[model samples]
Target: MKQSGNSLIEFLLVTVVILAVTASILALAGQTDKKRVNEELSDLATLTATAERALGMPQGHYEGLPGKLIDEKLVPAKMVDSAGHLQSRWGPVNLVPIDVGAKRLAGYSITYTNVPSPACPLLVKGGPKDKRSIRVDSVEVGSFGNINASALAQACSKATVSITFEHHLNEPGKRSL
Candidate 1:
């Protein structure tokens, strides 16, 4: 009886350790995935801003939607996927063109919504939370043109140019892991 009790306790101990280690590894993987997705989102935002600046530079005024600009060759096609959609690890990014009125161009803002995979665990907070969309309302686009500071300020005040991403969180491949 004494020997059987000891064997059972030992088995339980080993099982607990294995479970703990597996949990830690999965958590780490999730963190890494979140970081990668965030970086991709930032890159897309930067590219959009730069492309808009390029379009606005020649005319001393930047106006029109990103898609239109791309069609005009002002923005590169490489900036978006073959489907003409900007994509991140989380999913497709959509550009919401804020009309650049007769006013100057200020900065813009960004927001993201992620639909996590059922196969994966819940993501951590303060990054891209699972199944939730977060908006970074104010992203300032500085004066890329020769416009005056006052005009820039006015544009900033009234500008509605922004971007958003919404998609399912696809799982990384074995090589990525």
Candidate 2:
């Protein structure tokens, strides 16, 4: 009877330790994901500002700005892979020109593909808010200033998602999209 009681206690203690370890691991993973998301957002903002500075005037179009950024070494070295493609933790990062009207470029768009569902909301809500439009999986959720939480939740419910950030030019003499 004494040995049995000791065995039971030992079993319970081991189970408790396992549960605690699992919980700790989960918490750590969540923190890591959050940190990565924040880092990606910061990188995106830096890329936007750098591109704007390098491109000067809109010139009515910003086609191929992604390649230009890569060529000029404007992108962070860590984000660019060996093949010179811009990559994020989830997937590829693409930058394209946003044409307003009559081939006039009003702004640019940054699209992150293959984004995990869990990170979708974080990416959307954490992006630069001024003069930016956000879309999830090709569905327009909201602008930076007026995001709908419900809409975001619905749109982000997927195994993989794509988030696009349309950054309109807010400079002098440039029209905002």
Write candidate 2's Cα lDDT for 1-177 as tens digits: 999999999999999999999999999999998999999988888887776776735453576788988998998887888899988988899888877544466578889999888889999898867646789988888775679899999999999999988866664443443
TM-score of 1: 0.47
**Span of ten consecutive residues with least summed lDDT in model 1:** 168-177
Candidate 2 RMSD to the real structure: 2.6
Report the number of clashing residue pairs per model.
2, 1
State the weakest 10-residue window (summed lDDT) of model 2.
Answer: 168-177
Residue pairs clashing, model 2:
60-105
User: lDDT for each of the candidates?
Assistant: 0.42, 0.81
| Top-scoring candidate (lDDT) | 2
Give candidate 1's error at residue 70 in angstroms.
5.4
